[model samples]
Target: MASQEKIKLVLLACGSFNPITNMHLRMFELARDHLEDTGRYKVVKGIISPVGDGYKKKGLVEACHRLEMARLATESSEWITVDDWESQQPEWVETAKVVRHHHAEVLSSENNSNGDDVDTGKYRKRRKMEKKSPSCMNPKADRPHLNLLCGADVLESFGVPNLWKPEDIEEIVGRYGVTCITRCGSDAEKFINQSDVLYKHRKNISVVREWVTNEISATHVRRALRRGQSVRYLLPDSVVRYIQDHSLYSAESEQKNAGVILAPLQRYSKTE
Candidate 1:
């Protein structure tokens, strides 16, 4: 499905990058290596959908700020590309449409089109733009063999993608692939069971097991930030500093447990 214009792949990560952390980068790093080891080699495909902006998830600054930071955080990595599509989508659609978009492109080739009506010169430029533009060029799948990345909690919430429905998620995952960096034991099972329904794409649902990031959590980093302690070992240093720079969960809150602070806010601040 590739043309002389561009070589594309999707490396997806979904989460409340509430302010992305180092663990997030580490996860990506591991993801690339894991894919290479398996011979897929295009490990650094690109992030399809990422989580950001919510009430209880109360992003410290805002989505735009978070997106800028993410751009800065992964600016240096060739393998990383941000799909701000999810954050920008008003009602985030199922990841399947995005996956289907990729697949459609793959299923169809650029030059494969019938050349009867179109001018050759304009067509060449349009094909060029398709490679560089982040937006889907064709109405079909660009890279149908999509793989989504997420943590244990997000993986556990796989069934709940219904929250975004009438957009079906399981069907979407069935179309592409589900690559998870697992934490919870239950989600590991859920990912497997869900694959059964997707018998067609079962091989695509792969797990990038993590013994390294097992204990990493955004809530934990937020707690450390509030205590004015070093969260150096937790999230990415860039992320820690970004949180501090923005005064997110800083010592001013005097709240030791981030969960308590975020939870009571839901009960106390109904307008949120």
Candidate 2:
């Protein structure tokens, strides 16, 4: 009798990660723990893909900065890696496409390892087989299963009107699946029950309830920085230093004209 092959799992976390916080990193651990608790998957890699500048959200900062911050944040973690592919894109690419692109890259690399070109149609068929199989079993056992890791806030937003396309939602949930870490007051079950699409694909969504919640957000961090308050424990020390050194999120950052006004003062002032 042959032994069962262990299934490989990789998590892709897509977000702004303007200044990657401890909570952002925690989501990966929470999801990995939840999935490993099932005794069905062995999580190999965790990828943090920051959103492109094309998102155009206020206070988003630049993609280069965000990517560097993410890299710095996760440098100590062996399992986690930062992928700049999405950030390097010329324009904003949808989340679904990002997932597909990562999956394709993984598949292409795996195929190259075997010295063969990947066939898109055949890969899709293989994915379908893998998805249908039991947790501990896979027909094509070698391929790694890529899942989207996010917070419950992101999960709830999926149901928001005009936020995401119907097809993209279907592809994300139906194909890659999601592992959402529950935030305080965000009912993952209730959100699923309320939405027909979510309810239908509930099997693919794993809701990991967090007992002790960390309410630290980038917005809050930025606000604290702008007010000249201590964000010491909110962000990593290295990131904190980076922000201070770069003068990011400060009141001066918001005031474009401040440089001109302060140029003369800076020349005369000892604190300059």
Report the C-alpha lDDT of model 2 over 169-238, residue by residue, as the tens digit.
8888877788889888798889999988888889888899887789889988988889989988888888
TM-score of every prediction relative to native: 0.64, 0.84
RMSD of 2: 9.7
Stretches off by above 4 angstroms in model 1 are 1-8, 48-61, 90-144, 160-167, 184-187, 194-201, 250-272
| Model 1: residue 130 alpha-carbon error in angstroms | 17
Question: On a 0 to 1 TM-score scale, where does candidate 1 land against the true structure?
Answer: 0.64
lDDT of 1 by residue, 198-268 (tens): 44445555677776545666677666766778877665567656766777765544333335334324433
* Cα-based lDDT at residue 214, candidate 2: 92
Best candidate, TM-score:
2
